[model samples]
Target chain A: MSVVLSIQGLTKAYKPGVPVLKGIDLDFDERGLTAIIGSSGTGKSTLVRIINRLVDPGDGTIVFKGEDLSRIHGRQLRELRRRIGMVFQEYNLVERLSVMENLLCGRLGYLSPLKAWLRRFPQEDIEHAYQLLDVIGLSNFANQRADSLSGGQRQRVGIARALMQRPELLLADEPTSSLDPKTSVEIMELLKSQGEDNKIPVLVNMHDVELAKRFADRIVGMTGGRVVFDGLPSRLTDDHLKLIYGGEGWLQ
Target chain B: MSSASIPAARPFESSLGAKLLALFILAYACYALGQLDFSWPRFVKGIDNGARFLDRMFPPSFKNWDQLLTGFIESMQIAVLATFFGVLISLPIAILGARNLMPSWATWPARLIVTLCRAFNPVIVAIIFIKAVGFGALAGVLALVMGSIGFVGKLFMEAIEEISMKQIEAIRATGAPFASVVAFGVLPQVMGRLVGFCTYQLDANLRNSTMVGIVGAGGIGGTLFAAFQRFEYDFVLAILITIIAVVLLGELLANYVKRIFNGES
Candidate 1:
């Protein structure tokens, strides 16, 4: 498959001399899930955040379809951001807004500010939001306030909101961390299926190792802000786990 | 259990410093009372004068009904108009001052404007406006608008600052422009609080408008001032009672507005 994204020598440190993702090189081309698993504070979130431009990379070059994502500003950055959809750990739905309105937020980039302010979203977007609502199994909840939803329901809506962008690439930052096990699996399934169906690469940073192995087509294991393992789930040995996470007293 | 392992049985203690501070406050209060013209005889004479004044004000005569009616209507108009204009102006300033959404360059100026508006009392603001715009209802409206912006703008900025950044990020990631991000993400979170601010400004404006008239800016205070100056104590009492009634009515109306905007059927 042709490369959709390529990251070269990505290095970042919140404080200088203590790098988070140090000289990391990765590429995404295939249309499926690639899970990046690491213990907390390994800069998995920071890696994805820089890709979304939510966090600026200290030193690196991110090329998405031959465009340097790290250097673009203002209008160019917004145009680039449209092709990349991100889902947060907290679901991030506008709490006081209606479910339908929250979903329409996916199209906020497409509509003018005046149109959004007036809530005059185009007809196709409204229909698409309704369809996405059904896909996420919240058909009757379009009018319900987002705050009334459970954690799982909100995450489901969050996934749908991301999908509404029709993004070329989807980045999820520990999407299932706040969810129960069942909900986590369900969310993973939704992300995987949507990734395949839309033919968009899904890059996820997760804390749960087994969950990543089960759902990911390819797994990248990281430790201390560096990638330690990159291969299939079968190749992810206990030795590799120990190397990635360091010291396995809890593994017993 | 060992001493370190076992938690303390008593988790609370009143410090000696606190007790000392309380005693100092009490002593200062006693000293201040002694320094004032607060003798028992002075208090008794004051009470006697108040009773005599109340007796004269018993039959509150609305002898000049037309003049009273005009002043009352003018005050109501001033209050309503000021509230409308003030809330509209404050809305943008509030967004500007929110640290989360805006940078320091924008927030500092907006904050300074809000502070300037709030620094002066409404009567002081009214006198300033009277000097600028000439003695009329226009001065009252301008003064109250400044007061409303100062009071409501700070609260609005605080509400905006408290909103979830995740909400803004989600919309922004969708490729939405800055305006759309604010419209969909920022405004929804703050709309309820904004409605509350508007209603409060209205309530405050209603009271301030009448007072502004005393400074020759406009309203019922002019009539009240004239009555007091003419030794028409009964008419002054009538005006005072009418003011209290209107303020109470305004409170009820404000509550109703708040409820309607809160989306309670």
Candidate 2:
């Protein structure tokens, strides 16, 4: 498989001298769901955010699609961001807007402010949004306000919004953490299927180990801002989990 | 529980300072009443004088209907124009003043402008505009516009500041430009409140439009002031009745516009 993104010596600190990500190095495949698992405050969310430049990195060299993502800014940075899609833990859809309008927000990078304000989206974009709605199983909820939807339905809309970008790389920051167990599995299935269908690599941060192991083609376990395990899901043994999570009591 | 061991129950502790302040206020009120020559006989005499004034205003006259109609129309025009222009100008200024949306430099200047606009009452603003623009509906419109800005701009800025930043971050993540981010994320959140502010401002401008004319800024207040000066109490009552009717109509119109814009039945 081709490498879609390569990270080398990536490090960041919200405060001086106290780094959150400590010289992390990893690679993402072109077209498989890679789940990163770790305990709380393990820098998983920070790692995901840094890939899209949502949270700035202190020292790093991130090469994605042949360009250095660490240095660019202004128009070039925005252009790069348009090619990368991100989903949030809270399903951060515009609550007051219609579901259809929220989906069209993914295309804002291409349209001018006046066009967006007037809601003059191109015909093709509208059709694509409708198709995505159908895929997400909310085709009839096009006119409904986003805030009126349930948690699972909102997450579906969030996934669809990310897909609307047609991004080469999809990054989900704890996409299913807020969901129940059953809904969590469903969301993971959807993410995995969508990634395979679009041939886009998905990098997901997750807390649930079993869900990650079941859905992820490859799993990377992290602790203390460092990856201690990187291999196929089948290779992640109980001892490895203990080392990554740093407790044997929870293993039982 | 032993009474001696338990601490004294002090659920409601009243402040000595508060009691003293209340006593001071009562003493000052009594002193001021005496100084102003307030007495039972004076109040009785004042009531008699008010009754005689009311007797003169019993029969309202609308003989000069043409002049009243012209002044009323002018007032309406001033109100509509002021509301439209004021809301238009306030939108951008409010956006700039929103601390969350803009830098401190931008917010400081925009907030300062709104403060200056709110510094004077609408009547005082009308007098200033009347001096600058000369006596006409234009002065009235300008004065009401300042009042509208002061009302809507500050409130709208606060509404913008209170929006969920998560929605904005999501839009920004899509690589949208700054303006597009605002158009999609920020405006949608605040549009409902903005409609309410605008309708309320329109209603206020309508009422102020009439009052500004009394200060020679234009509208029906000019005619009403003239009748008052000439001791035409009957004509004054007619003008007052007309003003009340127009203001009621304005309130109804404001509600209707608010309902339409807010999508509420």
Candidate 3:
């Protein structure tokens, strides 16, 4: 196994003294699904956001492919971002645009603004986008506006968009929080398979313990902005859940 | 649940200062009416003059159709050119003025430009342009362009500001360039409203183009104003009908644009 991403001494604060993420460290060794579980406001979302620099960390070194992500700027930063695909919880598809247009957003980094404005994405990219739409099971919805889709269908498009990036690592922040149980399971399965198919690590931050246990290859439990348990799913017992979530009442 | 309970204080309490303020406004309105000589007899006399003038205005004659056609065509040209250039220029300015996207320094200058454009009326701006450009449709177009920029630019900035940043963040996550972010993320969120605004601006510019001509800018208004001064009320009536026809046609075009852009009626 080889380390893909490594975070050292990660710390962040929205206010001067109130830290949302304390000093923490993490590493992804092989292509697998790793779920980070914590209760609301326990910094689960912040943890994933820091990886993509969506939310900057106050103090840390995020090393991806031997380069410190925090130190990069401009074109280098964009190149680094290209290697990491992030699926948002709210789907975030451009509502007014068609599904195909939104999916082509995955290739925005590669295309120039002039090309994008003229709808001149490479022929291969357009074909690949259509293929991804099929993979996400919305082949006929290519021209439909994003706002017309259901919650599950929209998330499917969201997944398709991220996959279009062909990233080295995929990050999903509470991707299932806005979905129903059946849809959540289906989305988790879709994400897990994409990680397997691409041979890239998938990092998911969620609060649904059962869903995580069912889908994740490994689970990292967090509490009070710090990792309290990191191991295989079978090893995450109720005691650890209590420690991570700080209550046994939720177990019932 | 607490319907029987009495509240500690009245809900719609009118402060004493508010009452006094209302009274003062009423008193000031009366004083303003007196200062303007807003008397009933004056209004009656004005109505008598208007009645006679209206009687003379019946049976419009288009005997001088060539001049009327030239002025009408010029006005339409001014309106179309102004809308095209104004929307083009204001689009970029509005994007720069969006505070959520750009730094304060960038936003401030763009906002200031838009503010200055909107501060003056089209007629006043037309007069200034007429002086600089020396009485032509160029002045009318320039004046209306500034008006369109001011009106549409502010609305566009507000539309950009109201968008979901999460959409932008998703695009940014793809490592897209800044221009691509705006093209893919920002523009889509506001394009519909922006298009609606552009159509509205075109309609407004059409109406204002005619008015600007009165100030020696250029348009049908110059012909109409000359007819008025020459006491050619019958010709004046002809020009008014043409203006009304042009305005109606412009309204139809605007509605068509709106429907096409939004894909709805």
Cα lDDT tens digits, model 3, B1-265, are: 5866877758899999999999999999999999999999999999999999999998897998998999989998999999999999999999999999999999999999999999999999999998898999999999999999999999999999999999999999999999999999999889889889988988898899889999988989999899999998999999999888888988999898888976741
DockQ-derived CAPRI band for the predicted complex in model 3: medium
* Retained true contacts (fraction), each candidate: 0.91, 0.82, 0.88
- Candidate order by lDDT, highest to lowest? 3, 2, 1
TM-score of chain B of each: 0.86, 0.91, 0.89
Report the poorest 10 consecutive residues by lDDT, candidate 3 chain B. B1-10
Q: Compose the digit string of candidate 3's lDDT tens values, residues A1-252.
A: 899999998988999999988988999975999999998998989988888888877898999878898777789988888889999899999888899999999999888889988889999998999999888899999999999999999999999999899899999999999999999999999999999999999999998999999999999999888999999999999999999989798788
lDDT of 1 at B141: 93
Candidate number with the higher DockQ (2 or 3) = 2
What are the DockQ scores of the candidates, in order?
0.69, 0.79, 0.77
**Candidate 1 chain A: worst-modelled 10 consecutive residues by lDDT:** A23-32
Best-to-worst order by DockQ is 2, 3, 1
Off by over 4 Å in 1: B1-52, B259-265
Candidate 2 lDDT score relative to the true structure: 0.91
Tens-place lDDT digits, model 1, residues B68-103: 889999999999899898888988999999899899
Model 3 chain A: lowest-lDDT 10 consecutive positions: A65-74
Those runs of model 3 whose alpha carbons end farther than 4 Å from true positions after fitting are B1-48, B260-265
Candidate 2 falls in which docking quality class?
Answer: medium
